[model samples]
Structures are given as C-alpha cells and as structure tokens.
Target: ELKVEQNPLFLSMQEGKNYTIYCNYSTTSDRLYWYRQDPGKSLESLFVLLSNGAVKQEGRLMASLDTKARLSTLHITAAVHDLSATYFCAVDKSYGQNFVFGPGTRLSVLP
Candidate 1:
C-alpha cells in the first residue's frame, strides 16, 4: 500500500518569511506532483517533478523531489498574502491512473 504524508499540516507565516513543506511516501515513484487549493475550490497544478533532483519554481513557490529518499519538498520564498493556500503533494505510481495525495498543508500568510 502506498501512503503519502506531509508535515506541518498547518502553517501561519508573516510576509517575507520563508518555509518548507515536506512530503514523504511509502512507495517508489518516478513522478510527483504539487498542487494548490483555495478554500472551497479545486486544485491547481503547481509542479510536476519527473525525475530525481527535479525542481520547479514559480514566483514565491518552489518544489523539488528526491526519489531515492521518497521525499519531496515545497519551499516558500518570501511568502506573501497571495501565497496563502493549501498545498498538496501527490504520488502517482499506477501508470498515471491512481494517485495518492498527502494531507494538505494549510498556509496562512499574515500581513
């Protein structure tokens, strides 16, 4: 059975602060995906790490994966109010069909 876990399930940050959210999985995966969600909304894809050491960045958000350790990280740089949202990391191992998602990290960026 595959399980995805995320740390710091809740976070509160001030503007210009930085933090990292971690995702760990029980099974091996060649691809991992990061997504974001606002309250009562659907998820928006943020990053797709396809290989070891793969990294993606956009604005204040960055994500990377280390497949060998079954770990992935989402780093927040200089977080702002606009970056406040719930983030999730998903592991896909069933030929792009099944995906196990981590418990989302709810981030609240204060002014």
Candidate 2:
C-alpha cells in the first residue's frame, strides 16, 4: 500500500529559525504537492510539481521531490510569526484517483 508519513508532528521554533520536514512514501509516484494551512483556514496550495527532479519554493519554504528516493523535503529558510502554521506534503500516486497525505507538521513561531 502506498502511504505517506511525516516526522515531528509539532514543531516549536523561535523567530528567524530554519528547519526541514521530511515526507516519505511507500511506492512510486507521478506527482507530488505541498500545502500550507493557517489556523481556521483551508489549505493554501503551495506547489504541484511533476516529474522526479521537480522543485518549488515560496517565501521561507522550499520543496523538492526525488522519485528515485521516493522522498520529499520542505525546507524552511527563516520562520516568522506569520509563517506559524501547519504544513503538509501530499503525493498523487494514482494520477488523481487517490491522494496520500502526510501526517502534517504544525509549526509554532515564538517571538
């Protein structure tokens, strides 16, 4: 079965901090996506990169995919209070028929 898992369900980082969240999958994938969600808000779509060597970024967050490794990375450059939210990376393994979402990474920005 194709599944997704993320480490550190909760993260507390000081202002101007950097971190990385890892996403691992159990099987092959055709596309990978990154999403961010703020408190009480719906998912804010981040990236929908296709193919193996695809990478995308915005603000303090950068995401990359490795089909060969079946892994994805979300690197946070410098976290701020505004960046305090939950992040998730999902994989489209079934070509839109099914989506496997990671456990999610909740970030707390300390001022």
Best by TM-score: 1
Off by over 4 Å in 1: none
RMSD (CA, angstroms), candidate 1: 0.8
Candidate 2 — which residues are off by over 4 angstroms?
none
**Predictions in order: lDDT:** 0.93, 0.87
True-structure RMSD, every candidate: 0.8, 1.2
Q: Tens-digit lDDT track for model 2 on 1-111?
A: 889998778999998889988988989895888889998999988988788988888878888999999988888887888888998989887886467889899989899
TM-score of each: 0.97, 0.93
Model 2: clashing residue pairs? none
User: What clash count goes with each model?
Assistant: 0, 0
Point to the candidate with the largest lDDT. 1
| lDDT tens digits, residue span 8-98, model 1 | 9999999999999999999889799999999999999999888999999999889999999999999999999999999999999775647
